[model samples]
Target: MMRPVVYGALAVVLAVGPEMAQTRPKEAASVPAKSLADYSEAMENLAEAASPAVVQILVQRVAPVGQGDSQHMGFVAEQQATGSGVIVDPDGYIVTNAHVVQNARHIDVKILRVDERGQAPHGHLLPAKLVGLDSQVDIAVLKIEGSNLPTLSFLNSDTLRQGRLVMALGSPLGLQNTLTHGVVSATLRQLKPESPMVYIQTDAPINPGNSGGPLLDIEGRIAGINTMIYSESGGNEGIGFAIPANLAKDVYLKLRKDGRVRRGAIGVIPEAITPALAAGLGLDRDSGVILSDVAPHGAADAAGLQPGDVLISIDNKPVREVRDLALTVFQRAPGDELKMVIQRGKEQMTKTVAVLERKNEPNLLEDQASYDAALVRQLGILAVTLDEKVTAILPDLRRLSGVAVAAVPAEYAGLNPGLLAGDVIYEVNTKAIASLDELRAVLNEKKSGDAIVLLVERMGQLIYVTATPE
Candidate 1:
């Protein structure tokens, strides 16, 4: 079983190149006689409009490595990173890739103010604080205290036409104010290992340090954020991808309000419907996502969406991949109900599923504990307060009490009588044990010869065990 906590928060920032320019005007002789003047004027206006909003980001960080007594690894001393960002709001809110400033302790945002001559001679450098970061979307927002800074507006990504002229502006390989022009090579390009959604594919040279930069349409509206280049040499090879501005806006708003994106889960495993699998299951040649497992009493299970059932749609939108279904459901608020289309055998069925607030599950860690003998006074795993998921598996557990065993060490081996990994300790010698401190106090009351009894819940069964002090 996958532990589910492996996806750590890390946003990927992407950046651009110079002959493959997107907005460069061809020689007058090469252009059609009609609309030639308008095209040149529009290209000039775009460069004038978008240059002020893009900023460069410099970050410094420090990290710790290895076991005890190991030296501290410093992001500041070991390496330095540079990337680009866009000004999202007038109040100095900047949007960039999370990887640009990962673990950054200090961030500097430089806003370039172009002079009347179209030259960026002067600028202001401001420090920014991280607002929130989402690795799933590879986006992060930072807020700085500044005034009169320019901001860019996002255009609807759906309106972006394939092969439309697009401009990419950012620092590439530490070269500041570098500009590259190219067309939207393709739309709906899929990204992997993190974001499964589509990206805006461009042939523009997206190079290092161009990450977090803006991908602009001919009208100068922001289309996507420069994100990645699919290349073997780790350099641009005419293929790059940018997270669409529409999706970036969605992630930005969610991260700003909730401090994290809460994805709705119906607690069901979805299996992809392939041709062979569909034929084996007697399904249509082309149809829906198959439910492999239904978590009992979960939103999907409660809605009568059973295992092996084909989920065709949610709220009228076609549900193809599990990611698509997940994104569709999470766009709504908790407690909102929506229609779900499912197919069982040869019959198509519909059900309404209520969206529930996503609950955050933290890795269980034990509180500090001490031993009277062996002089072992190290803080180790103790117990944890029970939750709905834990209580459902352990029956006969009272509503108000029980601490799940989280950790154990070799020094505390004698205390491992009835305590197992999932065992919940409810009480210590009839004294209530809610938190680790309470259990520690009760255990401390023991004399050298007194027997200590612990009430524990092991796999839905409650039992009591006693042990003598060392």
Candidate 2:
């Protein structure tokens, strides 16, 4: 006999767990724990335990008339984007990638309704509402109305050792309740050099529709959220990434409660200490992070921290890299005291500083100067050419015939980084957009899942913004 993984409290509204009769585990399996002969069974057991919590997510937005792709891509007013999610709270709260549901005017969640014997009946769709989103972490919270919904167990990802068995569960390409098996290939895989968060790398065959689904450990506990894949063939080739459960937990809790995140900040940019700098600064090893710049009036400045100071540690955690200090500080709340040890000149000193609320900046715009315009609404933004009417409202934009965002839905505001009403988009992937037709041509050549770059001009300043088509 087999047993399913069941959960309780702040659990879920769907009542998805196996019936009470099957709640109790059967007699111990004959196979030894984690043995080669038992691994297959382990995977099966994991699937049985976690399947109830997996859900298919559908995000549909009504495209504006005549706004379809140029290649006769079959214009349809209502198009759907699909992904997956896992129930976390008994009250029907679910967790998924922000991109999976962003820009959707309508959100629907499909659950595998289960019977007493843990057998799934035909799944059903339930209307869901977006609770909160944390773009930086790529996590979102959604809610449906129900009670006693089964939820996945969250494990401490810090203890996730590489080479351990884990399962990726989700709907891939609309195939629901699918399970893929693999071992954690690496831990703490940094996606970008300067990114504050890192991912747990796996080989679990994650694909387009798998985003936001649970990556589970052998014990049927959620280890991470399978996010993306890297493949030359545009399919999973054993390289996949998942956000650690701890980070997801933090984001979901804050988003469900506050609907927004206010990350803490200390206005100081640090760089890894170099040999030359170490020699120039005096006798010392090239260790710890050294502040290269300090923002005026920011928390670091208020705490008397200045440029050229070496940050030895924060809150007792050694800071040898920029991310080391950044991840620690950014996760803290405003006014949280940070005990810092620093080396300024030859004097070693300690300082206690309060974290300041990080100020929100417009999406980092990379498109500077000017380009073209379009009526493309792929990224949930209705855009038009920066024509005479737009220039009259903002004289600074008069010279550039760029694509100006005309409108955006309030719920999906933060997803399109660095874009706003009236800002002109001048470039895409380095190609200049000089007219509406040019912008349409560039966008039409691309497909979903391809990342595009836009150089935006706002308030006489040029910045590059990166976004993907929905």
Candidate 3:
């Protein structure tokens, strides 16, 4: 009996050991290793893991200015807007775009229960309060009434590589619970030269209601927060951008603490290194940022750095453009030491610059943009009030004062020829528009089809534009 038991044990070891050895090769494979045939199934799993955290943001606010009957000017009419958001923390902290809830009187966040066996699932609607908003970065934080809520973790966007698969989960055009898959086309895309935040560009179908949604990577991590699209027709043109999730997380934490973003200001004004400037300065590269001015006694000034130094990197990270430098500086806090690499007349040297808090310094990069909420739409011109913020961005505007053009609707854009966003309207039909009320008073004098001349200021020059409103 003992001999037979020994033989049986030897047989068991031989049979089981061969199978175990086959399973555990020199390289350990992922548990339940994905077969090549399960590629489509993997994407489905990613969406399933993240879908439960995507929330629909519904807002009710006063109707956009000039949206109602012409007879009832300034009448408060109810208007509704729809967008998307994602729960980032288990305690019900939601992340969304600032523009979505800006000035909204009421906000509702709907949490979805993901369905694995079916195609659609109903969600729970809960009231959410705006915790904080940073319109500059276009990020907002909201608090909902729940605990142990479904949440998604954010991945460091710096690790994102171009051509990696990403999925945009949101509500597009009021269609709830939508998912679109695409690959990252570009990273570090900036809208302007001095934009403090960089974007991840993807060829995804992001539309009106898709703002503030989560852009998830294959691992179901939040890579970015869907923000805007570059479209000529006001529709998805395959160019959608997202705020990096890392930036969104940082903004969320700071906004929660102080209700606003506290940025590190080095007090160095940088300009794009254009071809002519590069050639003149003998810079081997023509793309990096150049320190044009260093404010007296500021962080950059205290660091023994001088003007005309080409900034090449920060903290050993390469700074390829002006936005890159600005974004890195914005990420740091006061008293943080930043390691910088600069090209000084063919000599590449590294310097340590201390970051300081920005005190009342105007964010010069904030563009003077208009919104429909401030303009009467029939005139097809959406203008915004120009104040210190606008003047800071365009120093030339400091001397001029008036309402700046934010948008020109397409229908009346041709009629109001030469009118463009950023053009400050100093006067409307001979009446100076020092304030919004003054501009409204001037427009109250106009009749249908009446010809109007606007004294507009654009880029240090003044001109008169004529238009007739129907």
Q: What is the lDDT of every predicted structure here? A: 0.71, 0.77, 0.80
lDDT ranking, high to low: 3, 2, 1
The TM-scores of all predictions, comma-separated, are: 0.66, 0.69, 0.67
Q: Model 1, poorest ten-residue lDDT window?
A: 367-376
Reference-based lDDT, residue 378, model 2: 55
lDDT for model 1, on a 0 to 1 scale? Answer: 0.71
Please provide, for model 2 over 331-418, each residue's C-alpha lDDT reduced to its tens digit, 9 standing for 90 to 100: 7877788999998888989988889765423231111111112225455455666555445444555356777665553434434565
Query: Residue 345 in candidate 2 has what lDDT?
Result: 80
Per-residue lDDT of model 3, residues 1-470, tens digit only: 89999999988767777668687653456644557438779877877778888999999875435544465443445689999999988898899999898757789998886457775657878999888787878998989988888899999998999999899999999888899989999977777754687899999789999999999898889999999999999999999999998899999898788666766799898888888988998888767789999999998999878999988889878887777788888888778899998988879888899998765333312223323356555455666677765554345563456876666544344345577666778887777888766777777778888888888777678888887766
- Candidate 2, poorest ten consecutive residues by summed lDDT: 364-373
| Ranking of all candidate structures by their TM-score, best first | 2, 3, 1
Pick by TM-score: 2 or 3, better one: 2
Q: List the residue pairs that clash in candidate 3.
A: 370-406
Best by TM-score: 2
Whichever of 1 and 2 has more TM-score, that candidate is 2
